[model samples]
Target: MNDQVELVAQAIYEAEHGVCLWEGEPARHKERFREYARNAIELLDEDIGVLLLALQEANAGARLRRSKGSVRRDPN
Candidate 1:
């Protein structure tokens, strides 16, 4: 797959096989895992922010349409 997906998969594999790779330089591995976790969290936060903005825009549009329709139908 793409580079980002590959990197995430490799990190997950390493995490799952921690027991096998823990013999040497466990501290270094732990630090790398922390980096991976931080990157993943940052990506997730960005995606959530985009989704929230889109939802808000959609809600505002729906409200505007309903208000306009009601104003047109008013007898006064």
Candidate 2:
């Protein structure tokens, strides 16, 4: 969980906070970072799902949120 969180933070920083320093065509850079951010979001969501399952198993009464009609909600 810790590793996953750190990885997500690093990716988000690279996508958003690090952009000003990158010397490249703006549109291209934005597209690239968008992809990176999307991937990182997927990773973070998966990691959170794993942790949520662990919590549910350990504490049977614990309940996680649900997505509208889907089965899960993001930890964020």
Candidate 3:
């Protein structure tokens, strides 16, 4: 991947893995990811193609990437 893609993925990994101060600490980053994922799904559904298909594709792609041990680095 290009530099921009790598950077964006690094940013996402940082966001998903937030800071923790102590043992058994609650992760505050998941909430942000959930919120952002929801908003993205909503906005894309409204402006792009069908929601169901988008969600299906997202799920399938996620599964494939995970199974292949390949992290998705966006070109954003």
Candidate 4:
């Protein structure tokens, strides 16, 4: 519904329809899609909390590994 989402949606539509609105190489359009997708994800992160959940899981795994002494030591 916001500007970033709108841009991503339009890029997706163009990709599906094989249409390019920009006056550049075809690869630029693909890059635009990537940029738009990244921007959309960043914007959504504020409301989604996915990053926080991932970090929490990572931290828990690290703690469990530390508690179990599962860390590997380098052999010299």
Among all candidates shown, the one with the greatest TM-score:
1
lDDT of 2: 0.49
- Model 3, 1-76: lDDT tens per residue? 1332322333344455663222343456444444555555555565534644544475467568777877666889
RMSD versus native structure for model 4: 12.5
TM-score of each: 0.36, 0.31, 0.31, 0.31
lDDT of 2 at 13: 47
> Model 2, range 1-76, lDDT digits (tens) per residue?
4444433443454446754243344766555655665565576675666654544463333222223346666889
Off by over 4 Å in 2: 1-25, 46-76
Model 1: how far is 36 from its true place, Å? Answer: 26
RMSD of each: 17.7, 13.6, 13.2, 12.5
Residue pairs with colliding backbones in model 1 are: none
36: Cα error in model 3, Å: 0.4
Count of backbone collisions in candidate 1: 0
Against the true structure, candidate 4 has what lDDT? 0.57
TM-score quality measure for candidate 1: 0.36
Using lDDT as the measure, the top candidate is: 4
lDDT of 4 by residue, 1-76 (tens): 3544434545554557675454354666656665766675677777535644554475467569777787677888
- TM-score, candidate 3, is 0.31
